[model samples]
Target chain A: MMKYYYDLMSQPSRACYIFLKKNKIPFTPCPLRITKGEHRSEEYTKINPFQLVPAIEHNGFNLTESVAILRYLCREFPHVGEEWYPSDSKIQARIDEYMEWQHLNTRMQLAMYFQTKFIIPKMTGTEPDMKTVERSQDRMETILDQFEEIWLDNRPYVAGDKITVADIVAICELEQPSMAGYDVTEGRPKLAEYMKRVKKHLQPEYDEAFEQVYRVRGRFWGGENAPHSKL
Target chain B: MMKYYYDLMSQPSRACYIFLKKNKIPFTPCPLRITKGEHRSEEYTKINPFQLVPAIEHNGFNLTESVAILRYLCREFPHVGEEWYPSDSKIQARIDEYMEWQHLNTRMQLAMYFQTKFIIPKMTGTEPDMKTVERSQDRMETILDQFEEIWLDNRPYVAGDKITVADIVAICELEQPSMAGYDVTEGRPKLAEYMKRVKKHLQPEYDEAFEQVYRVRGRFWGGENAPHSKL
Candidate 1:
């Protein structure tokens, strides 16, 4: 049996978790709470030197990085719908383009917004810096515009008409800041439609993965070390 | 012929340029000079919404992001040998791991070092702030340590004994700072040896792609813009 290590609070980990479950890949879910610093424990570090989430241990082959794990799973379990990772060379390239671009565009940009607006200040019980929050929000808005105009652009999905890992990964990052009470897809019809399509397509797994993250938004609203929101 | 849009000064651009050339993939080199602000042109903007280098247009399919382009080229031209991408699923996953991890770890970190230590100061005609430079350099060094100790761990190549696209992308980013007369490989025997191995494997194409980036080191040594030193 494969051992999957993750914390849903992590945007990338959600992608991996959703991917594995959606594909019906049997694996043990080993939740490592990032807020508890469990990810940095010596044991976890032995699994992933970077001490980040979305790592898997299968038959002694350990791997980290959500995109890598996703791609590996696609190959390791081809019985799953090919739309998630497509078999055609051209379509795979398109999916690869999105996966690669989102690292900086969708993922990192939103993480900046979430960390500045919520994570750092809440975790430490300090007042969130308005200036930092405003700056990140501004950056997020610009990137979201790019996401809407360039990426969505009336396309049914990020890759094409079907929901793929690219859409799953994109939705995970886009929704990460919702843990801070911010929705980047707000007011963007194309993105919102895309989100709706993704949400409906992913169904209960989508809600289940994001439920804890959204619950976290309430836990730290007024700061002052709140009980760890059961993720 | 495929169309390649690039600027040698752009780190990611170098990766795509080298991969395409090394594999003998036919592409019309369309160099976009970042120093001259050519990449921000409206025409180029239509091609890449992010307006970044290392984009490709092939059979009406346009793609940005060097990793995507490299993977696409590998798939579109499988005759280039499986070692660059690998026919084995596990090996491909390892390469994907490196490519994904490198975005935040290797690429962004090195770009920060080069930008703060060189580009920002030179472009603005302002004195390079030692504090900022030191901070970025510190970050760069830490990630390099990660790359060496955790990543390499004395492996002959990034993904294993054979060379892969991961090596190509990593080498481009590692060499990016040499334009500032700085070598991250310096004082690190393992990284230095890894660079030697990559360079030897890549051969003349490696030197050819990095030519202009290496030449830029000579143009602004004393904080003044010198004539473009021929690469």
Candidate 2:
């Protein structure tokens, strides 16, 4: 059996979690509480030297990196959906292009914004520097513009009309800022609609995976009364 | 014929260039001088709306992003070597892990350092902020440590015993800071040896592809007498 390690708070972990649930792949769930430093334990180091979550242990093979884990699972499991990761070389390359581009763009920008505004402050029990938060927000806006203009222009999904793993990973990143009470889809109808479509397509898995994020926000910003009460 | 568009100055572009050459994939070279703003031109946007290089146009299928281009080329062309991207599922996943990990870690850190210390200063004809350069260098050092400890520990290559596309991409990124006269291999015998092995194995192709980078470094730092005179 495959052992999947993750934390719901992590954007990529949720992506992997949704992928697993949607694919119906059987795995042993090893949820690590990142805030409690479960990932930093010496034992986890043997599994992933990097000490990051969203790792997998299949049989005896160990693999880290969420995107790699997703790819590996698709290849290893016969039942995994092709619509998410098509075997067609060109379509797969298109998906690969978005995945590669997002690492330093969508993933980095939204993550920085979320951490600067929410996670870091909550963890340290201190106020975040306003200047740094503004800078992160500014950088994130540029990335969002690019995401809208370049990736999502006149397209229903990031890679193409059909939903792929790119959409899953992208939505996961885009939602991180929302946990900080930031409205990322504000003023961007294309993105707003895209998110709705993605959520609708992924259905129960999307809502189920993001429930923890919503709960976290509710706790941080006062239950059910926060600006982004629902994602 | 496949149309390859790139600017050798960009790290990923050089990675793709080396892969194509080493794999003996035939393509028409459409070199874009990024410094001259060729990549940003309206004409090039049609080829890659993101306006970045290391793109490809094969059978009217246009694609961007260097990593994706390399993967596509490997799959599209049978003459491409298997050792660089093995057919073994586990080995490919291992390579995938590094490629995914490098984006925010190795690629971002080194590129930031290089840009802060060398490229931006040269482009603006202004002295770089020492504090920013130092911060970038500090971040890069941490990534270098991870690269040595996690990836290269007790192994000759990044993925395993044989050289892979990950090694090519890794060396390209690790060499960027050197252009600014920083010895990244200092105090790290493992990384130094790993780089040497990668360069030796890829040889001629590695040196050939990096010639432009060496020229850029030499021009910026002054002839062969300048520090890091040759990569």
Candidate 3:
């Protein structure tokens, strides 16, 4: 059996969790409390020097990086269906394009949202810079616009009609801003509708896993930490 | 035949070039001069709105992002051999860990080198800030040290004894500092040896492609009438 080391609130961890559960892959969960700084402990650092979560240990081989783990899983369980990771050259390329592009665009943009919402408030003991937060929201909006126009177009999901890992990756990052109290769905109707479609496509097992994680977060924070609600 | 749009000086483009050549994959080379802002042109942006180079068009599929393209090629041409992309799950996961880790750690550090050695010099119209350059170099050294301690250890390459795309990705970024006139090989015998080994593995093709693009760069000026390097 494989062991998954992750924190539920982590965007990438959720993506990985959703991937594993959706694929019906079984693994022992080793949840870390990132907010409490458990990831920085010497014990955890030995597992991953980078100190980030969503790592895995299988048959004595330790691996980190959600994207890499996802790719590895795709190889291991090829029958999870082609939609998660399309075998078609063009579709794979599109997913790849998103994966690479999102590092700077989506990843960085979401960081701004996180910094403004959680990090700044927690660190400074003051309200976040609303101007910066607004700017980040605008930047996210621009990226989303591009996602809709270039990637989504008329398709029900990103990278064509099927729900690929690209959608999982994208939705997770988008969820960051939503968690930060911004209603990403309000202004972007197509994106909101697409999110609904993606949720519908998620397997019941995966959905249940996500719900379990969400309940834990909600109880911890005393608010609507549900996937769809603002964090 | 596939067509590759790239600027060899770019780190990611070099990764793609090295992989394509190493694997003996043939494609029409369409070079973009990043110094002249060719990548941002309307024509080029049509191909990749992100305005990054190393975009590829194969069998009517247009793809950008070096990592994605690398994976696609590995899959499409399985005969390229297992060393480049191992088939085993555990070994492959190790490779994934390095690939994902490099994006922020190694890649970001190397980009700082680029900023200090190239961008800053071009901007200030004088020698770059040596203090900043040294700091950036130190950052890169830290990453390289970790690369050896955590990832490389006693192994000949990143994944294992055999080199994979992870090595190619790692080395390409490391090469940027060297190309900009820093002797990265000094004081790090293991890294120096590894560089030699990587070069030796792909030298024939690497040198040939490098020479072709290296000479073309001499004709370039920063802007319409900006000063060019005399050498």
Q: Name the best candidate (by DockQ).
A: 2
DockQ of each: 0.84, 0.88, 0.57
Tell me how far the alpha carbon of residue A158 in candidate 3 is from the true structure, in angstroms, after superposition.
2.1
TM-scores across all candidates? 0.93, 0.95, 0.85
Error of 3 at A157 (Å): 2.0
Q: How accurate locally is residue A78 in candidate 1, as Cα lDDT from 0 to 100?
A: 80
- Per-residue lDDT of B1-231 in model 1, one digit per residue for the tens? 889999887778888887877777889989988778888999988778788897998888888888888888877888974858988988998999999999888999899988898889988999889999999999999999999998898588889988888998898888777776676766777988888888888889887876676566665442443222212
- Candidate number with greatest lDDT: 2
Clashing pairs in 3: none
Model 2 CA deviation exceeding 4 Å by range: A221-231, B219-231
The candidate with the higher DockQ, 2 or 3, is 2
What are the per-residue Cα lDDT tens digits for candidate 3 across B180-212?
555566667787778778777877866765663
Error of 3 at A91 (Å): 2.9
Give lDDT: candidate 1, residue A57. Answer: 97
- As for DockQ, the candidate ahead, 1 or 3, is 1
Candidate 1 local lDDT, A138-158, one digit each (tens) = 988888998899888768988
| Model 3: CA > 4 A from native | A81-83, A129-141, A203-231, B124-139, B179-181, B212-231
Error (Å) of candidate 3 at residue A98 is 2.4
What is the i-RMS of every prediction? 0.8, 0.7, 1.7
Shares of reference contacts reproduced by the candidates, in order, are 0.93, 0.93, 0.71
lDDT of 3 by residue, A6-107 (tens): 986777888888888877799998999887899999988878887889888877777788888888788777887475887787787777778767776777
